[model samples]
Target: MEEFNGNDQAFTRDSLYGTASEPTYAGVTSFMRRRYSRDLQGVDLVVSGVPFDTATTNRPGTRFGPRAIRTASVTSAWERHYPWEFDPFDHLAVIDYGDCNFDHALPHKIPAAIEAHAEHIVQAGCAMLTLGGDHFISYPLLKAHARKYGALS
Candidate 1:
């Protein structure tokens, strides 16, 4: 575990696919293994990759959006500026929980897997920030969250 700056926190890497000799960009293993400046217990946000883009309109590679976002977020070195003058990474606890596993053989399995995973996260008392395979992924995420926390009614 590595700490950025003088922060006394370490990020843990968790993979659903198990470990491999090399990292995988298309799966959850790569996303979870990135270093960050916070601990899971102290995390205010858990960003995850939900790479399932069966409904892509143009390019099909949008399914990889989650992995791309995770890479961008971790590699970013932007400092905060404004009323608050601290690094956002230093203050907010965020982790990449990696991608939700979906069955490519069965299209319906995508939504089911997403909902199940999101429910578990919500039940754990953490807010889920997810990457999309497509915009349609939002529907299951919201549905699961709403079921647990109730809708905006």
Candidate 2:
């Protein structure tokens, strides 16, 4: 288990797989625990966020959306929900794979960053549920999905 002394947190290597190398971000396992109550052995769905809004009307903080959503998801976990009775966690595996790190210094890099990041997830054979950094982020996400699944038309 990898232990962090500053936050008094400890997580196994398995829990940290596929997570960013930086310690600031939460691991997939921790995100899953915050979002659902089930083991993630054969999860069918993936919930991800793309917090890279360089083109927003007010662009200063849209990059923070991923962190905000993750916080809210953790808060909502213990709250009562109708689906709780059905144990939705047992049926599905949900995770937040953190956010796509944008190169704010080079705004033009956003499209490629978003495309590559989303493609990694799609290629892993997981369904994506993404939060937005900006509207443009969705375009690359859709394109990546289309490349993987082919165009509907």
Candidate 3:
């Protein structure tokens, strides 16, 4: 397990390289207790939420999925990620970049919004792990990633 000084390591820490000190039930809720930031300067990977559920075919409650996932991850983040026995934070620089922004009234522009949001992150030389919105959101995300890394093989 990684070590931290106190609560709220998310704000005080300068890099995404260390584990958070916040306890499972307290402090800010970021994915794996990573810092919440938009700065991608030296970040290796970004975890962001896509709270859109408009494209879902069935239940439309995925908009809240990201937050719930982040909250639940607190317990797991305190230790190495399962059987892997290795702390990813020790190698990868990651941060929770918050959620993608879009205007709910403009349904047709949603895909574009998602693509643009992801594109910005990819363009900054950082990989992304999106939380949730709907299965359809992956299509736009793929497009953005492909544009950055080239055709997936």
Candidate 4:
């Protein structure tokens, strides 16, 4: 197992229930170096990105948040995370679903796009870990989540 986990498990591993010990600077930069899969068969969680920031009243650079976050996640991809007794990947089948696809030209429709993206995962019985874009991304995310699991704070 050590021989396999020692390399790029992001696209090489056959399973989604273990850790990836690839060099922090190399390999597919998926969230936590997890496999970049759209298959939700038995997945417990889906990490996706929403690169939309046009709605922000402040700076409009948040469109790149998702990519930035994915890059940063690499620094902590190996072994057990600090302060935690166990690695979540060891128990949960997590995958990087990549970024939400939407027409940035149609800002009005981005919210619905985000909502639907989340709904697909939730409906599949998998949890979501959305990244990037702006806080407004929450508006659509919460709506999708509420539909699946009921009221949320």
**lDDT (Cα atoms) of all candidates against the true structure:** 0.59, 0.58, 0.85, 0.86
Say which candidate scores most in TM-score.
4
Model 4, position 25: C-alpha lDDT score: 77
Question: How well does candidate 1 score on lDDT at residue 152?
Answer: 47
Q: How many residue pairs clash in each candidate at the backbone level? A: 0, 0, 0, 1
lDDT of 2 by residue, 1-153 (tens): 122223212233333222122233443333433333223345566666787766777556767777676655543343235654544544455555656767778878879888998888788787777876767788889899999999945
Query: What's the lDDT for residue 147 in model 3?
Result: 94
Measured over all alpha carbons after superposition, the RMSD of each candidate to the real structure, in angstroms, is 7.5, 7.4, 1.6, 1.7
Please list the residue runs of candidate 3 whose C-alpha ends up more than 4 Å from where it truly belongs after superposition: 1-3
lDDT of 3 by residue, 104-134 (tens): 8998999999999999999999989999988
Which candidate model has the greater lDDT, 1 or 4? 4
Comparing 2 with 4 on TM-score, the higher-scoring candidate is 4
Residue-level lDDT of model 4, residues 1-153, one tens digit each, is 123555566678778887756898777788888888999999999999999888788699999998999889988877787898887888898899999999988878888999999999999999998897878889999999999999998
Query: Which candidate leads the pack in lDDT?
Result: 4
**Alpha-carbon runs more than 4 Å astray in model 1:** 1-42, 78-84
Model 1: colliding residue pairs: none
Please provide TM-scores, in order, for all candidate models, with all chains considered together: 0.68, 0.68, 0.91, 0.92
